[model samples]
Target: MSRWSSETSKKFILVFVFLFLLYGCATAPVTGRKQLILVDPQTEIKLGLQAYEEILKKEKLCNDPTINALVQRVGMRIAKASGKNYDWEFKVIDKPESINAFCLPGGKVFVYTGILPVAQNEAGLATVLAHEIAHAIARHGAERMSIAMVAAFGEVLAAELLDLNNSRTRELFMAAYGLGATVGLILPYSRKQEYEADTIGLYLMAKAGYDPREAIKFWERMRQAASGRRKIPEFLSTHPADGKRIQALKNLLPQVLPIYEKAEHKYGLGEKIPEPHCR
Candidate 1:
């Protein structure tokens, strides 16, 4: 009787997982990659808005007219090219030491001052902005969150079914599962997303009239900037190696160059970025 019950439980779990995956299946934009995103778009956007509001309240915003103008100019162009009807907003963060930029789900983009020098010119800035916008368009944040939720549920189910009565054994099992899932599933998916973003971003920048080749140069400069730092292995890190990213961008130039040429208003790198004097 107990064996029959166990078999029934196993079958039920399998059926539930199959249904869950089928219900949550979605395809990413541009790449057409299928995804398992259980989170709804409305909830994801609400979370993004809340996070954006909290971040803006905490971070010092750059008030320099020149910097603001540059960011808005580049960001809006990329946003327009994306064809996503997001409530786009762009702001420069006054963090001179943090070299980063990100876009929230609803198209809230924030660029740190430190990354501007690396961006150097308008096309380079467009590379950064377009990549971030691609992340939002692809719904990567919600996808990641859904992956985490599924992982957690799997862990709980495993614990219950395995009958891990010994505390130490249960701990070991959970730890192993966490490590395996992180190394095998989450990290690889993150790298894939980064590569996907690079692809979509290249298309976006070209469509928006920026030279797609500048992306390679920008990433090359980034590689130089990180020359002295200890490198994380590509397998372990969420982002791909800078060299790999540069190579990928180089490989993609052939496809995007035609798009750039056909763009209605070619900016050809536009204006050089000026140093911000935050008021």
Candidate 2:
């Protein structure tokens, strides 16, 4: 009975915070999906701009003219297709060891040079850039911060209910909230966001005259590259397994393919990116 009462109290606290987040709902730009965005667009944009500045200060900008031109060409096409009048900028980071790329809110895109090998052509690069840009337009970052706040609220409630002074009890509270909220609520939400990004990215890339089918090829290459790496359990992972992601993209192709077929320029694979002797 004692344990049951405590469990019930925890549930009530989580529900309350969850409902609070729901009150600040916003719709995602491309998909029109309703999302819980605790932060306003202005605030999100401000934070993103600040973060982007900080990142630029820390990371060396790639001085390769060829790489810069390639990213700019693909990026501008996608940005125009998005139909959002964001002050957009595309840049390449000089990090050869990092396999990551991202777009900050309002369209600051930073691509790592290391990813160039994997994104062997313009279409492949389009897939990467478009997906990252999708995350920004979808306002996934705001939604994630909102969820994290709710998770933090749960921790506070647990601390009040349990004996915070006890080390064992503190451990229990931390582990329960940290692992449960992150792996349970956040991971599933992120997977959903990831799929949404893929869908929107296909549209943007196809509309930008890049081949949408190349997204699948890019992911297959990503899957192969990631094969030997240790994977987080699917239920606890933020991103879906590469195979699952590719399958979902395949299902969505019927919708995205027509957009590609009708594109005015239809630069199929566009230009082949030069093999990096930087490798």
Candidate 3:
């Protein structure tokens, strides 16, 4: 068979698989956003649990009872509000220099000790935890994977059409595909996921009895902390800029405030999260 004909046949198969997957969609909880999801819930959960176990074995876990108790308290409250039926587990990772936190698909949450200082108190921590939980509940990673599959298939189709054989062709193909996905597809969705996580997280935190207003304060502190370092301009960055994020939170307050007001056991700005004794 001619190279052109052979490549065209394979390209047709990739297109079919791509469209088949796109047809399988799921709506995200809380936000009700229609997400293009191709992965099975059970598979995603198993992968999350596997990764959680692997990370636990590799990373230094904070054995401080006080911090663990606090993380469990905040994590459980938000998880309950999120209405996820998974076996939720929260752990404090002893990474004092890395200010980060995240939730895996099956409700495993990890908080870095570094972010604790920025969190300052229980309410601030609630903001961070809730946001991470929101991402998991929304299956943002799966949505991205779905998008990535489409992008990859498109790249394959392009490669087949070009039928280039030089080593430089490989380099150009990588550059074109990476830049295209970054600029045209993935980054925008990442920013959207952040905003959705923020919105849903605010509601969850408020419903869990932590004052939603504290989120704005936490983000203000985050902005100040980030200001000391150089940052990629907002347009080029995956996350919304500090000013924009805080404003978005402020704008959302009107919607979440009533939920906060009605919370039966409000812990507005809770107590300070004393310095990590484990570090």
**Candidate 3 ranges with C-alpha deviation above 4 Å:** 1-23, 154-189, 230-241
Q: Rate the local accuracy (lDDT) of all candidates.
A: 0.75, 0.73, 0.73
Write out the backbone clash pairs for model 2: none
Q: Give one digit per residue, the lDDT tens place, for model 3 in 47-166.
A: 566667766887899989999999899989899888889899999989877667778788988888988988999999999999878878887766665555456553445323223343
RMSD of each: 7.2, 7.5, 6.9
After superposition, candidate 2 runs with Cα above 4 Å error = 1-23, 154-189, 228-241, 277-279
Worst 10 residues of 2 by lDDT: 173-182
CA deviation > 4 Å runs, candidate 1: 1-23, 154-189, 229-241
Q: Residue 51 in candidate 3 has what lDDT?
A: 60
Candidate 2, 63-119: lDDT as tens digits: 778888889999999999888799999989887665667787778898888778778
Stronger candidate by TM-score (2 vs 3)? 3
lDDT of 3 at 178: 22
What's the TM-score of each model vs. the native? 0.79, 0.76, 0.79
Q: Report model 2's TM-score to 2 decimal places.
A: 0.76
